[model samples]
Structure formats: C-alpha cells, structure tokens
Target: MPDFQKIPSNDVIDTLLKRVSVRKFTDEQISDETLDLILKTSFRAPTSSNIQAYSVVVVRDQEKLDALAAASGGQRHVAQAPVFLAFCADISRIEDALVRNGHSIDSNNLETGLVSAIDAALVGMSAYLVADSLGIKGVMIGGARNKPHEVAHILGLPQRVFCVFGMSLGWPAEAPAQKPRMDYDGLVHFEQYGKSRSGADAKKVVDDYDVALAEHYRGQGRQTTDASWSDDMDKKFHPWLRDDLRERLKELGFDFR
Candidate 1:
C-alpha cells in the first residue's frame, strides 16, 4: 500500500475533498437557485487585470444537450447531467467595449488569447469547487474541443469567442473511487529543479500507486487490465492525438497570427 497523507484543513471544507469526476449521475434536477449560486461563485474568480474575458453558456434544453453529447465523442453523461455549461474564452465582449470607447481592438493579438484562456480556466476551477461545495457532482469535458466549430455554432457564440471546455453537472448516483495521483516527491521540486528522478525512483512511486489502485478497484469488483501507472500513462500520452483546436479557433474568427 502506498503511504497517504490527509489534508490539514479542518475548516468546514464544504465536502470539496469528497469531489470526484462523476461520469454517472442521478435524475435529480438541480434547482435554479443552486445553479445561480454556482455561476455567481465562478464569476467571482480572480481574472488577469479583471478583464473577465470569459463567458459561460448554460445548456438546459435537452436537444442542445444531446447535440453537445454527440460533439463530445458521445459521452452520455453530458446529456444525462441536469446542467451543461460551455465555458468560452471570450474577447468579443471586451473588443466591443473598447471599440465603443474609440479604442482600436486588435482581435489577433496573442496577449488577448492568453488573457481569455487564463480567465476561463480560473472560472472553470471556481465552478468546479462551487458545485462540489453544493453537493453537486461534475466533470470537466475537455472533449468539447473535439469539434469546436460545430460546438460554437450550436452555442451561438460570436466571433472572437471560443469554447475553452464544458462541464456536466448533476448529483452523483454512486460514489466513485478516488483516483490516485503521483507522490509529492515525484511532482514537487525544491526552489530549483531537482535532479531527474524518472529512472528507478519514478517507477517505484508509480508502481506503488498502481498496486493501491488495482486493489481498490478489485475490492469493488471492477477488473482492470493495467497494473502499473506507466501503463495508464502510455495510453494517455499518445503522440497521434487529434486536436484541431488551432484551425477551429481560426475558423471561429480568432486571429492566431
């Protein structure tokens, strides 16, 4: 068994620690009040220069949710969730404001892209925490980028706005096992970068986690073929990954020049 440490915080952590990416959800409907609170909390997230160059489109309509699920590689949980939110890196709103004030807005600027993406990420993280606090289970859908152009069309997003990602939210029907992560020693380095430990030390740390994970799954009667973390990493880090985000963003009127 791999040695584990507990979180030090005792402040009513609002069940955030209990959060896991829930792929399965109950049919329970999340109240509009709860949804509003989640969105409000997300908007409160800190942004670069307070530009807030991001927007979220909440999809409650069943047909739209189904379309999103299809776009997301047929992930059924997307349609199953009571709420689906598409978080966008939006510069159009800022550009409009600037233009109205007689300021020339260059939509092609890389700095604008960076600010929007960063703001969206911060807001997404905030939404995740807020939903978790409200006893809502959610999963971040990076797969939303699979067909970014189609997703943008479906969401009616304006030019200079791109879907950063999506989130499926609802109450979990069953508790999911906590996924194991790399050890602190493996991930953290001192002030300066430490010597490469990806040889035996890395293997040992991952091997320990593999055993723990496999055992945990086995106890739940789930059969896992991969016995080591390296095996899982190999599956995840494929070189021929299909990400057409650059082209799609360009098509959606983002000048990535």
Candidate 2:
C-alpha cells in the first residue's frame, strides 16, 4: 500500500490534486449512509439553467451487475465494487414536464443533448470528489459505452436517458502510482492556442512518459511492454477496436445535427 499524507486543510484544490482513479478494490461493502452522501454530493453539482438534466441508476443486484460487467467490456471492477452507478444524460424528465405544461420538446435538439451530457459529467465528477473525501476509491468506467444499447436495456433507462458512463466505488485493494501528466508549458497557454511543439520534442516527452508509466506499473506487479505513451495510444486508436458510440448516442435520441 502507498502511504498518502492527509491534507489537514481539506481545501478543494488540495483534495482535487490528491485524487486518483482506483481500479482494484477490496471485498467490502459501502454503507448505505456513505452511498447516500455520495449521491447527494452529485446532486449538488452546478447545471446549465439548473435543469439538472441527469439521473443515476444504482446497480446492487448481482445478476444486474453481472450484465453491466458484460456491457462494460467485462471489467470485473463493475461487479466487484460495492456501489456501481450508471450516470445518465437524461432529457426525458424535462420533455415529460414540458408535455405536462402543454409544450412539446424535441429530444433531437443539439442544445438539449449538450446540456444533458454536461449535467451528467458534472454530477459524475462531484460523486468522484465525494468518494475521495470519504477515503473511498473509484474508477470511471467509460468502457460502459462499449455496448450502450445493452447497458440502457439492462438499466431500464427510458428513451432520451442515455448512459454517459458508469462509476465503481469501494475500498481500494492497493494504491496506484501517480500517472505522469504532460508538461504544463506544453499544454497551457496564457490566452490563445499556442503553436505546436516540434514532433521530435513531443516524441521525446511521450517516450519519457512511457518509461515512467511502465516502471510505475512494474513496481505494482503489472505487465506492460510499450516503451512510450504514443505506442500504447496507437494500439488503442484502431477504428475497428473502437465502439460506434456516436451511432449508439443517436439511437438513444441525441441529435448530432
């Protein structure tokens, strides 16, 4: 286990800086009170017009969790975590309300879709922060979109309520090493977008990161062979290996138009 010093002040900036994604979890259950607090924290996130166009489905049933695991590309963490939450971009509630008030809303509108997705992401980030504050570990499972339709069916989500992602929370079995980030000078600009660095310079930085990551994983007893971040990213970028989430989103009533 890695020793992490507690930040006494509990300042939001310090808390955010210390948070890391935890994939491996211990065999322990999260208490109902903790779960409630996490959900309530999520609900407090700022929303566009306070529409709060999002909802969460908590998966506790073993069979349902198993199905979700399958939908999430067989990530065992989905089933192993004490709490599995599917954060949704929900336009359905707003549409229903509009109908009841004698106004019709189109689910295909670009603005509506964007707002729902924004709400879901904000709420999910809040949940992660809350979990970290309580010493609980979590991982965001973007892999849940590998089979979005199947995930929606499993969760019994209504039309216009799409699964944006899933989050798994529990006590971590081990602490993961801090992943290296790109140099701030390379990423951040004062006002406008900056000119790109030379390819050689970029490659050198990425190669260094690859070495750092491989060593970090090796220290944790995980196997990895890529000598650079670019190599691993290239392997993951194949079109065939990627899921057609855009089409899935369209089917869930989001309009790219």
Candidate 3:
C-alpha cells in the first residue's frame, strides 16, 4: 500500500498550500528579467496538441493599466499593480499559420473556442504558481471578461482573440486572511458522483459551509448573514450577470453558434 503520509514536502507544494489572492501591493515593481523568466517558464505548461493557442499581453504603462482597470469595472488593484498580464485566447496566430499552409480557421466552433480558452487558463495558472513560488502574490481578474470588447480595444487584440482573464502582480503590502474552501467530499468524487449526491446532499454541504463562512466573516469583523456564501452567490449570479457577454464574445469572433 502507498504511504501518503510519508510524502515529503517541497517548495511548490508549500507554495500551493499557502496561496492566497493579494489585492494590495507595495511600490516595488517586478524586474523585467524576473517577469520574463516567469512568463517563459509558465509557457511550458501543457498545450492542446501543442497549438499554443494563447498569448499574454504585459501592461506596465500606467495609462493603459488605468484603462484596463476601468474596462474591468474599475478594479483599483488592476490599476495599482506594477504589472497586469492579460492572458488571451488567440486564434489569429493559428489562422495566420494555417493560411501559410493553404488553410484557415474558417470552421472554428465551440470546441475550438473551448480549447483555446483552456489553453490560456492553463498558462495563466502556471504563471501565477511560478510568481507565487517566488514570493510575488496576485489575483486573477476574471472581470477582464466583464467588458471583453473594451479589453480587446485597450490591448489592441485582433478579432480572433480575447482576454480570457487578467492578472495583477507586485510585491505584497498587505496579507488578507485566506478564505476557507468548500468541503473536500463535496467537491471531490470517487469513481463517479456518489449515489446520494442529490440536491439534499449538496445542500447539506453548503448549509454547513454557510455557518462556517459566517463565523469566518465575523472573525474578520465583517458583517454576515445566516446563509453567507449562498446569499452572496445568489446576489452575484442572479439576473444572469454579464448578459451582454455572449454577444460581445461573438463580436470578438468566437463562434459558439
């Protein structure tokens, strides 16, 4: 039998365990050499069929960062961070390469979009992990998608490309308490979803989590409700947040139709 307890700890493992989203940072900027090393190392992450259908736009200009901050719904962290990395799902390069071979991405479909987005997500995560290991902390800005069209315009991205997400990186000035996560059994399943994994089972997990999260909020001197997590999720997800996203993505040349 394998002895899981005997597994030795390593730097990467420690980094993963200690990972937290950092929004505030000191005045220090990430050195160009260090940024290059992080990006190059992260690009080594697995790509689908080696297509490498992703691109990263490094923004250091205060004006552009400010524009991006507005594009992402006025996220001050985006504007304040020393660097903002926009990880993009880009098919334009692939299309260009295909044209050289007498073909084009004319038949792009949902699968194609999904593959490219997944590729960008993988590389983005790899970059974050690399940065975290080096004591640089940051947060993933999914709000970059809140206004995809504006993001493309700000980044000067071509039609067949979109910012899947953005990341802000810098030296930390504050360490916010790490939030608790959902129960493991609720998220991880063996063989298949458990036989009792129905609405009640799921709700039980969430219900327990609600109480735990309420306590967590109280500990942080923040207000909380009885159903803290669920209430917040409902508030954010209700009314179908970002109703214009599908059309915006279509305008950006992502074919989900």
Candidate 4:
C-alpha cells in the first residue's frame, strides 16, 4: 500500500498537498456572495512588481459555456459546470497604466508575456485553493488553448489580454483518487543542483514509480502498461502542441520578442 504518513498534519496544508482536479460535478448552484468573497479574498496573491496582471471573466450563461465547451475539444464539463472563469494574463492594463504615467514598455518581450502568465497562474491557483476551502471542486482547462483564437474571440479579449487558462467550478459529483507524484526525494534538491548520484539511481526511481503507478491504474480497473507514465509523456510531446500558438499570441499583441 502507498504511504499516507507523508501527508501533512495541518488540514489546510493537507488539502493543498492532496488536491486532485474534479471534472464531474453536481448541478448545485454556487452563491454569488461566496464567489465574490473568494475573488476578493484571493486577490492577495502576490504579483510581479505588484502589477496584478490577471483578470477573470466568469461565465454562467449557458450559450457561452456551450461555445467554450466546443472550443475546448468537447469538454462537456465546461458547459455543465456551474461556473467557468477565463483567467487572462492582462498586459493591456499595465501598458495603459504605464502610458498614462508617461512611461511606455516594449510589451513585445517574452519576459512580459511570461510574467503576465505567471501572475495569472498564481492567482488562478489561489482562487482554486480558496474555493476548495469551501468544499467546491473544480478543474483547470488548459484545453482552451487548443483553439485559442476562437476562445479569445468568443470572450472578446482585447490586445495584450489572453487566456492563460480557464477554470470550471462546482460541487463535485464524484471523488477521484489522489494521483501519485514523483518521489519526494527525487524532486527536491538542495546544496546546489544535482543529478542522480549514480547511473542506477535514475532507473531505480523510474522503475519504482512505474510499479506504483501501474498498480494504481490496476486498482482503478484501468488497463495500463508498466511504462504508462513514460508512454503518456512520449505521446504528449512527440508532436509539438498548439502549432498556431505563436501566431495566436502575436495577433493578441504578444510578439514574444
């Protein structure tokens, strides 16, 4: 059996450490007040230079959700979700601020885009954690980028404002098992960067993890091979993702220079 002793003792910390995305949710409606409170409270998330480079567009309208669902490669959860929020990395707002103050930035730089996206991601996770505290379950929608231009067009996103990702939030209808992560020691590093201490070290970690994961799949009644993780990674990266990503970002004013 997997070790549960490694989990945190604090409830909040444990909650964060064990978080798994919930795609299946009930039809229960979330209160406007609770949503507002979460947004307001989680705005305390740190931002690069305090620029606060994120904005969220909440979609509750069925038509818009359905369009989003189609845009996300038929992710029906987006439509069925009680609330969907498009978290945008908004350099447009910062650019406006700097221009009004007689300062202009070359927003075409990749660092600008990176910071904006990082800011959006930080706040999005903060929002998710806050919602989780209230027993709300949700999942992030990276698939929204599969047809990003349409997503931006549907939401009327302005230049220098793009969806880094989205979120579908509601009460969960099913509780899924917590997925295994890489071994704690395998991931954490100290006293400068280090590789596996010996040639066999790498294989040992991989082989052990493969067994753990394959066993996990079997427990879930999933038919998977021992190399499931590597196989999935190979499938994911053999073809580069989102061929139009650069052009789409360019059209949105992120030239990435």
Candidate 5:
C-alpha cells in the first residue's frame, strides 16, 4: 500500500507520477500556438556549456509522417500522431563556428557525442512533460536509430547531425497505466556507484520487483513467465540495441574512435 500522507500534492509531481507513454491519440490536431509554447518551454532545459547543440525538426506532412513510421520499425502510432518531432544532436553549427575562428574540433570524440546527445535528451524530456501539462501525450521512438542514414536522408540533416530519437505526439484517446520502475534503494547508491549492488541486496530488490511487476502484468491479462522482469532484462541485452550505430555514426562524419 502507498502512503498517501507522504505523497506531495504539488501539481508538477502529480503530472510526472501519472505520466505514461501514450500510443493512441484522438484526431484533434495540436494548435500552432500550443506547439510554440511547448517549444519555448523545452528550450529552457539546460544544455552542456550552454552550447545547445541540438535541433528539433517538427514534421506534420502526411507523406513524411508515413515514411517516418516506416523508418521507425513500422510503428503505426508515428504515422497517425498529430505531430512527430525528430530530435537531432547537431554539432555542424559549432563546427562551422570553429572553422571561421581558425580552430577545429579534434575529430569527434566520445565527449562530443555525449554532450550533444545529452542536450537533445534534456530538451526532449522537458518537451514531453510540458506537453503532458497541456493534456498532450506521446511516446519516444528509439527505433529512429535503426536506420539512421535513411532517417537523415528523409529529414535532410546535414553532416555532424544525427537523429538521437523521434517522438509522436497528440491528445491521447485514453490514459494507460504507468509501468513499474526499478526500486529506489537498488538504483540510488550512497557515495559511489555499485556499492549498493551487493549479491544479496541486488537479488532481493530484483526479486521483489519481479514479483510486483509479474502481478501487475497478470492483473492486465498479459501472459508471461514468473519473475518476468529478469526475463525482460535478458531479452533486452540478448539482441542489443542498434548494433550498427557505431558504424553509422562514423559514416556520418562522427569519429567516435
């Protein structure tokens, strides 16, 4: 049972706690004014060194949306959503500034990639939350990385820019139950990481979460084996995500070597 007394009544916390990735949406189009507001709010998200090295391409054309849906592993929600935003980690602009100033980046390093991607992610989360405040809901499509070259071709992205991910947005048709997350005790370590991940403590938390999530799934009539969270984790790492991402990045002029 949850302790209602401990739950804060702040509106922001309430919105975040209830937030779920909404896949189904109504036909109503989001107004331009509202979209602008969301954009402004999302831009307020902090960027690394204030470089703000990210770009969001607002796509609404039906043909382009359909193509994006196909690129994103045939996700029908991407095609049907009122809007799709392709968030790209862009350093091309910075590269140009460097050339004019007689200095150059030392072949794209890990830190370059990290900062740009982080910039896009911060903005994306802020956008999602702000949009949710206006009753808009959406899902982030990480499948955009499945064919990064194709996505770039479709979006007309320049060099030093790549899609970190895409998002499909609209007014939701109905609310979906929020999914369970890992326990705070297991996730939050004291002074250093992995200190809390002892054999006994890790198993205890994972086992407890497995039972809780299994019960949650059963309540929703989802068929699966016992202790499903571990099974889910196994499946996640077995195939790995976008194994070709490194090659694709190098091809796009990013020397992550």
Candidate 6:
C-alpha cells in the first residue's frame, strides 16, 4: 500500500479536510474590497488552453436575489446570503472575439460546452476555498440549474452563457457538522480502475458508508435509515434529475452535440 503518511499537511489542506457547506449566514455583508479580492484571485485558477470561457455575476440586489432564490428551487440561502455569485459557463465572449477575428462559433460542440463548464467549476472552487480561508463560509448552489431558462433570464445571460452553479457568501450564522463521505477504496483507484477490487467489494464499500453516514446523521439528531446514503440517493436521483436540462441547454446554445 502507498504510504499515506507521506501526504503533506498545511493550512489549506487542513481547511479543505474540514470543509462543510454553510447555508445559514449572519446579516453581515461581504465588503466590496474583499469580494473583489476573492474574484480577482479566483480568476487566476487554471483554464483550458487559457480560453477563460467563464464569467461571474455578483448579485447583491434584494429583488434579484429573491428572484434567483426562487429560480434555484426556493433555496433561501441564495437570497439571504450577503452575496450570490453566479458562476457562468460562458462562450459568448469567445463568439464575439471570433466574429472580430473573421471566425464564428458554428463549430462549437460538446467539448466546447464541457471545457467552459469545467473552467467555471475550477474558478468557483478556488473562490470558495479563498473565502473559507478568510473565515467566510458559503455553499455552492447547483440548484441554479433547476430553472435554467429562468436563471438565464434573471441574470440577463447572453447566448452561449449559462450559470454552471452559484455560491452564496457571507459570515456564518450556523456551522453544520460535516457529513461522512464514502470509503477511500470506493473512490480512489490505483494503476487501474479499482485495481484488484471486484464489483462486490465496491458494493460493500458503499454499504459500509451508508451505515457510517446514518450514524453521523443520528449523532446530529437527524433520524436516518441504516442505508442512509443509498436510500437518499435512490429517492433523489433514481429518476434522474432535471430531465429537460438537455433541451434547455440546447436552447442556451449547448446541445451537447
């Protein structure tokens, strides 16, 4: 087995290791200077081929925040947080640049969409990490995609641009316990997928995690079944989610080819 003791430890590593999503926040707003620092520093995150196909819309207006909260399936944190940052996967500027250089975005396909989304994700995580390191707490809102068209309209997004996700940032009012994660063997592979592990072994890993997660919830005064993770995931995703996402994204200029 690899020597896990060789892993380096640092402030960033410790912060990430204990990271938990923060949904409740104090009334205090993030200052413009700090917000600017977070954004500028986060934009430094690596992008594919330096395409930088992303943009962030900072929303502080109460009316717009309420609308965005509704758009995000009634996530109150989206509105209550001092600020909401809509991280967009944007190829609009790329299209505009192409036009200026005698080219067009007609050649765009799945890879174009994936690259832009990945770029946005990278920057979003960087922003979250920076904010957390500064003692600010927040949660990533994937619910921003629950109403894609409405989100696009609310944010005045242009063609080829959509909110990949959002983040609500502020000082914390509550600190929820970090939930348990799946076993390392279930997630990490060696030279090959699962290495010598069999499908039965993978299933066992998830089953064990289910019990551990259930215990974690119980400790927090939340009732849960022994198969907490599996049951919750099955109920949440067995039917798949946002079934109309493909059509919606296509209308937004990402057809996934």
Query: What CA RMSD would you report for each candidate?
Result: 4.6, 5.0, 2.2, 4.0, 3.5, 2.6
lDDT of each: 0.82, 0.82, 0.92, 0.86, 0.89, 0.92
Tens digit of per-residue lDDT, candidate 2, span 1-257: 53446645445777687878888888888888888999997898999998999999988888898899888999888888878999999988788899999987764677888889889999999998888888899899888888888999999998788888899989989787777676655565445556344333555666777888887778878888867466677778865554566777888877756
Task: Give me the displacement of residue 39 in model 4, in angstroms.
Answer: 1.2
Colliding residue pairs in candidate 1: none
Cα lDDT of model 4 by residue, 1-257, tens digit: 74769853776786787788899988899999989987887789999999898898888898999999999999989999999989898988878888999987654688888999999999998899999988998999998888878899889998888999999999999888987876765655566444533423555677778888888888999998888777777778778778779888888878777
Each candidate structure's TM-score, on Cα atoms with residue i matched to residue i, is: 0.84, 0.85, 0.94, 0.90, 0.92, 0.93
Error of 6 at 120 (Å): 0.2
Q: Roughly what TM-score does model 3 have, to 2 decimal places?
A: 0.94
- For model 4, the local distance difference test gives 0.86
TM-score, predicted candidate 1 vs. hidden true structure: 0.84
* TM-score between candidate 4 and the true structure: 0.90
Ranking by lDDT: 6, 3, 5, 4, 2, 1
Which of the two candidates, 3 or 6, achieves a greater TM-score against the reference? 3
Over 28-89, each residue of candidate 6 has an lDDT whose tens digit, in order, gives 98999999999999999999999999999999999999999999999998899999999999
Point out where model 1 deviates above 4 Å: 1-8, 11-14, 101-107, 195-228
The C-alpha local distance difference test score for the whole of candidate 6 amounts to 0.92
Q: Which prediction has more favorable TM-score, 1 or 4?
A: 4
